[model samples]
Target: MIIGVVLLLVFFLVNISIGSVYIPIPQLIHGLLGADLDKASWETILFLYRIPKAITAVLVGISLSVSGLQMQTFFRNPLAGPYVLGISSGAGLGVAIMIMGGSALGITFSSSSNYMTWGIWGIIISGSLGAILVLLLMSLTAWKIKDSMTLLIIGLMFGSASGAVVSVLSYFGNAEDLKLFTIWSMGSLGGISGTQLEILSIICFIGIIPVIALLKSYNAMLMGERYATSMGVNIKSLRWAMILSTGLLAGSATAFCGPIAFIGIAVPHLARMIFRTGDHRILFPASALIGSCFLLISDAISQIPGSAETLPINVITSLFGAPLVIWLILKRNLSSEF
Candidate 1:
C-alpha cells in the first residue's frame, strides 16, 4: 500500500508534465508551487488544464477501482465490476436521456458539445439516479438468486436493456445532439475544472467513506454468506452499503467523464495479483492507488506526450486495459482469486 501511494504521486506528477508542451520536472513543480516559471503559458497550462485533468484521473481511478473491489467482494466473483454488472451502462443511459432525449421531453439544458456544458449537477444527479435504479433492481434479483453467474447474466440483461434504450434515443436525435453525445461517450478527462472538479471530489469522497467503514465486513463476506452470517455480519446491510458506495462512485465517473471501460473490472484483479491476498483491507487501498496510476498512464498516452493532437481517453483505456486484463485472466486463472 505504501508503494502504491508513492507510485500514484509519481504518476500524478508525470501525467501533469506530459501534455502538448512537455514541462520538465523542475518547471512543473515550480509552476504548481506558485513560483515564477520560465514560461508564463506553463502556469496557465498547469493550473487551468493539466492539474484538473490529473485530479479527475485520480478521482476516477479511486472511484472505479474501489467500487470494483467492493462489487467483486460482494458478488464473490472475480469478473464482477460496476461496468460488467451494468452500473456504468445505467449511468450512461441517464446521461443519454438528458443529452439525446431530453429536448423531446421539454428539458432545456444546452446542446453544447462540452460535456455536461450547461451545469455541473445535472449530469451527476441523472447518472446517480440511473445507477441507483439498476443497483436496486440487481439487489432485488440477488435476493432470489444465490448463484453469482445467474446474477451476472441478469446484470448483463439490464445492460442490454439500457443499451437498447440509448440506441432508440440516438436514432431519433438530430445531427447536433448525436454529435454531442458521441463526444461525451468518448471519455475525456479535459475540461473538468472550477466547480466541477470540487463537486466530483466531493462525490468520490462520499463513496469511499463506506468502503473504509465496511472493511471488516468485506473480509468476512469472502468466506461465504453462511460463514459471514455466523460471524455476526449483517449480510443485508452489508449488501446495501456496497450498493450505495458503488452507485456514487461508478455513477459519478460515468457522468463526469463518460463511459470508462475495463478499469473497474481489471484493477481489483491487478491488486490481488500484486498483494496476493483477498483481504479488502489490503485490496481496497491498493486497487485505488493502482487504478489511479493506470488511468493517469492512460491519460498521458492519450496526450501522446508531445503533439497537440490527442486521442480519446476511453480509447486509450480500452486499447491498453483490455489486452492487459485478458492476459491476466488467462495467465492467473482469475476465477480462483475470488
Candidate 2:
C-alpha cells in the first residue's frame, strides 16, 4: 500500500512536471500550494494543462483497470478487457451519436450551458445501457448455452454492429460534426476540467464500491464460477453488479477521456507479475496503481518536444500498448491458467 501511494505520487508529479513548458520544481510547488506568484506562462502551463492531464490520466487508469479486472473475472477469460469485449466501442458509439448526431439533429451545446450537453450525458448513459443490454443477453445465453467463447463472439458482433451504426450516423453528419467526431475519436487527456473531474471521480468511486465490497467474493469467483457458487456467491446478483460496475467505469472514462486503450488489457498482467498472486484483495489495488502509473508515463511521452507537435495520445498509447499485447499473445500467457 505504501509503495503504491508513493509510486502514484511520483508518477503524478512526473506527469505534471514534464510537459512542454517545463515549469521549475519551486514554481510548480508554489502553484500547487495556492501561492500568489507572478503567474508566469510556465506556471499557467503546469496548472492549466498538465494538472488536468495528470488527473485525467490517473482517473482513466483506475477506471479502465478496474473495469478490465471485473470483465476478466466475470467472463472467466484471462484476455478479457474493456476494448476486447467492446465496452469502450459501445461507449464510443454513444458519444459519437451525441456529439455528431446531435449536431445533425440541430442541437446546439455550448461550454457554458449545462442543460444543452445533457445529450452528451445521454450518449454516455446509452452506451453503458447498451453494454448492460449485451450483458443481459449474455446472461440468458449463459443459462441456455455453455460456451463462454460464444458469448464473447456475441459481444464482438454486438460491438461491431454498434460501430456500423455510428458509421452510418457519421455519413449523414455535416463536415464540422465529422471533424469533431474525428478529433474526439483520436482521444486526449486535455478534455476534462476540474468540475468534470469531480463528477468522474464520484462515478468511478461508486462503480468500484461493489468490487471493493465484494473483494472476497471476487477471490472466490476467480477460482471459477462453480467454486464461487459452491462458496455461496450469488452468481446472478454478482454478475449484475459487475456489469453495472464495468459500465460505470468504462462508460465514464470514455465519456470524459475519449476512449483510452491498452491500460485495461495490460495493467492486470503487471499487477500479477508484481504480487505473484491472483488474490483480488491485492490484485485490485495494485492493478489500479500500476494502471495509473502506466498511463501517466504514456501521457508524459505524448508531450515529447522537437516534433511538429505533441502526438495524439491514442497514437502514443498504441505504440506502447499494441506491442505489449502482441508479445503477450505470442508468448501465450493470455491463457486462462494464468
Per-residue lDDT tens digits for candidate 2, residues 279-321, read 8899999989988888888888888943335767878778987
lDDT of each: 0.84, 0.75
> Compared with the true structure, what per-residue lDDT tens digits does model 1 show for residues 89-185?
8987887888778767765454544444655466666776778788788888878876656767888899999999999999988777677668778
List candidate 1 segments past 4 Å from native: 103-122, 132-154
* C-alpha lDDT of residue 117 in model 2: 52
TM-score of each model, in listed order: 0.90, 0.84
Top-TM-score candidate index: 1
The candidate scoring highest on lDDT is 1
Clashing pairs in 1: none
